[model samples]
Target: MQPNQHLRILTISSMLMLVLSIYMVFVYAPLEIVMGAVQRVFYYHVASGWIGALAFLITLICSILYLATRNLKWDHVALSSVEIGVVFTSMNIVSGSVWARPIWNTWWTWDPRLTTATIMWLLYAAYLMLRQSLENPQRRRTFAAVYGIVAFVSVPLTFAAIRIWRTIHPVIIGSSDPSAEGNFEMTPPMRNAFFFSLFTFTFLYVTLLWHRIRLEQLTVQVAAMQSRLLNKLST
Candidate 1:
């Protein structure tokens, strides 16, 4: 099969899984006794958070590969991953705020998980901005690789925040701390839906990453062509 055909298949699979996941969240899963309808947000919320972290993890690995091999392909992958990670992290944070308004009585809090997540988003966002400020392409990619590796400290830190510090954030999967708010047990159907949503988001991430890598490659080609044209015009 052609590359586009393969991408199409993956994209279609992601869309179908996304539709099914929505049905599961709204129609299949049981409603929480406490939060009522708002609890449904938990499905996508957790999935987005998972994708966000997963994307950053990819960037870290690619960054390492780029530094070791000095391959521009790895740098391309790292940049694409960071861009996707930022969007998903933004979704995670926004969805959390929407869910929290009713449960926590406020839209924002200084909870450890929340704080770390915000910081993680900002770090990656700054990474993108850092690329723009640097004029030397080689210097930019090298710096970005180093920064991407260092910034990944936040991924583990954010993940462990709820576990280590006193926080209102709930760990829905494992045992929850007594101090944690919005804790709930998942029924069989809810678990199915939750896992399915995670699978769907992973699929979506793969599809998006493929598209992004292609776009980045095309961009590099265009920029090179423009530079060539400029030199010819100057001569």
Candidate 2:
């Protein structure tokens, strides 16, 4: 099959799975006796956070490859991944705040997990800004690759914050600290729904990353064309 055919299949599959995941979250999964309806957000909340970390991991790998081979394509992939990573990280943070409002008695806190996550978001946001502010394309790409590599330090730090520090954030799949707030046991149905959401979000990420990389490629081609046209006019 052709490449477009693959993308088409993925797009359709992602859409269907997303709808099914929503159903599983709301209807299939049993509600938490404690948190009530608000517990439903946990399905997508952890899923988006997984994607945020996954995207940055991909960026880290691509950035390393770009540095090793000096290939522009790796730089493109790194940049595209960062763009997607930032958006999903935003979703993760917002959703977490939404879930926290009632449980934590406030919308935000200075908990270790939350603090590291916010810092990670800001670091990548700065990466995007740095790329756009540079005048030279090659310099921007090279510098961004280096920055992407270094910024990934925040990803692991954010992930480990709850585990390593005294924080109020609950670790969903693992043991939570005694002070952790909003902790609850996952029913079998909740596990199925939560895992399915993770799979669906991953599928959605692949689809979005493909489209974003294609757009970046097209932008580069258009810039090349414009440069050639300007040269011809000068002659």
Candidate 3:
């Protein structure tokens, strides 16, 4: 199949899955006895958070490969992952804040999980800015790769912050601290919807990443063509 055809299929599938996920969340999933309708946000919120972490992991792997091989393609992959990570992480943070308002009685808090998450987001944002500041392509790739690897350290720290330290943030899957404010048990249908949301978001992430990589490849091709044209004109 042609590239455009493949992309079209992916686009259609992603949209369908997304629509199904939304219906599952609002319609299929049962209302929480305590949190009521707001509890539904947890599905996509956690899914986005997972995708954010997954994106950082991909960045770290690409950064490693770039450093070892000195391949600019890997740098492109790393940059793309960081860009996606930032988008998903921003979604996670905003959705968490929205979910927290009614449950925690405040839109913001300095809890360990929240604090580390904010720091993680800033770290990746700085990664993009660092690339922007550098003029030399080699220097930009090297520095960005190193920074990307180092920045991923924050991902694990952010995830473990809630598990290791006391926090008001609720733990959904595992044993949470007794003092956690918004923890709740999931019913069978909620569980199904939750897992399906995860699957849907993961599929979406792969689709987006594929397109981003293709865009990067096109960008490199364009730059090369421009350089060759300039050289010919000068000759």
Candidate 4:
């Protein structure tokens, strides 16, 4: 297939899967008895959370490649991954807030998971800003790679801290037992919807990452061309 044809096919498939996932979430998935419509937010919430983590992991991997090869393509991948990860993670945090408002009785809380997510968001924010401060593209890429590795190491630790904290304030739900508040037993359909959403979002992430990396490559090419033209004119 031609490159444009292949790109079009991937775009169409990504969009179709996204639409199906949305349909499953709103139409087929049953409303939680306790949280009602609010619990439905968990579909996007968890999916975004998963994708965000995956993006950071990819960023770390791309960082390794950049350091090993000093290739600008790896830098583009690393930068795009972090940027896209930030976008999805931001959505995850906001959707978590929407769900938490009714269920947790607040829009924001100091809970471990919530707090760690916020920190992860800020760390990437700083990473991006650090990249912006450098004038040299090579230096920016190397610096960002180092930061990516450091930032990724903290993701698991943040999760572990939050999980441990949630153990104390856990609420009981969907069970006669008092210790199971957040645990909603899923019907088969709901399970299907949840997993389907996850699969769809993973594909969506892949599509977006590809597009973003392409954009970065184009931007770099334009920059190099402009520099060459200026040098020619100066000579």
Candidate 5:
């Protein structure tokens, strides 16, 4: 199939899955006895957080490949992944803050998990800024790959902050510390909804990544064509 046709299919599928996930989150999932409707946010919030980490992992892998092969294609993939990662991480942070307002009684906190997440987002944001500062394509790609690899250290740290230290953040999937707040038991339907939301987000991520990669490819082609046009005009 043509590239446009494939993108169209992906767009349709992602939209359908998104709609289903929203319904599952709001209507199908059982309401929490304590948190009520606000708890529903947990489904997409956790999923977006997971996707953010996954995007960083993709960047890390692409960075490694670019460093080893010095391939521009890998650099493009790494850049696209980091761009997507930043957006998803921003979503995760915003949703967490929204959820925190009612549960933690404040919109912001210096809790371990929240603190590390903010730092991680800043690190990646800096990575983008670093790329913008460099003009030489080779140097830019090299520095970006190195920075991307180094920045990934924050992802694991952010994930483990809650587990390693005492925090008010809730642990949903695994063994929870006694001090963990906002923790709740999930019913069967809730579990199903949670997993479905996760799958939906993963699918969405793949679709977005594909589109972003294509955009990067088109950008390179346009740049090359422009360079050729300038050279011909100078002659």
Candidate 6:
């Protein structure tokens, strides 16, 4: 089978999975007793967070691969991972903000999770810009790989720092009860929706990453062909 055909199948499957997840979230999931309709946003919010976390992890791995092999394909994979990571990270923040508005009584806050996510977004943005500044492809890849690996060190630190800070300065409401912060007890239907959302988003992530890497490959091929054409014309 052709490579493009395989990609097409994956793409279709991802779309179908997303559609199914939406159905499960809206129709099948039970309403929360506490937050009502707004609580539904948590499914997508958490899914985005999960994908973002996975993306950064993949970025770290691909960065190591690029450094070891000096292969441009690894660089492509790293770039694709960062780009997709940024997309999901943004989604996570936005959805979280929406969920917080009704529950937290504010659109934004310096809560641990919110602050950590913001910092992560900025770190990846810097990585993307770093890639743009260099003229040489090899140097660009090398620097980006280094940055990808190094930037990830902050992820763990950010999480730990947030947890520590929250402990020192806890939320007044339900601060005593750990569950009060995001503590909606899930009914069986809610649990099904939550798990289904996670499953669907994971499939979507794989599907997007595959297509993005293929596009990068095609781009390299096109550039090589164009360069060859130019050389022949000049001769």
Per-model C-alpha lDDT, please? Answer: 0.95, 0.93, 0.93, 0.82, 0.93, 0.82
Native-referenced Cα lDDT, model 2:
0.93
Query: Candidate 3: misplaced stretches above 4 Å?
Result: none
Which one wins on lDDT?
A: 1
lDDT of 2 by residue, 1-235 (tens): 1258777888999999999999999899998999899999888889999999999999999999998999988998999999999999999999999999999999999999999999999999999999999999879988999999999999999999999999999988889999999999998999999999999999999999998888898899999999999999999
- lDDT (Cα, tens digit) per residue for candidate 4, span 171-224: 222223243245567788888998999999999888899888888978888888
Off by over 4 Å in 2: 1-3
- As for TM-score, the candidate ahead, 3 or 5, is 5
**Which pairs clash (backbone N, Cα, C closer than 3 Å) in model 4?**
171-181, 172-180, 172-181, 173-180, 173-181
- Which regions of candidate 5 fall more than 4 Å away from where they truly are? 1-3
Q: Which segments of candidate 6 are over 4 A away from where they belong? A: 1-3, 158-162, 167-180
Query: Residue 90 deviation, candidate 6, in Å?
Result: 0.3
Stretches of candidate 1 off by over 4 Å are 1-3
Cα lDDT tens digits, model 3, 109-192, are 999999999999999999999998999888999999999999999999999998999999988989898889989999999999
Better of 3 and 6 by lDDT: 3
Candidate 1, run of 10 with poorest lDDT: 1-10
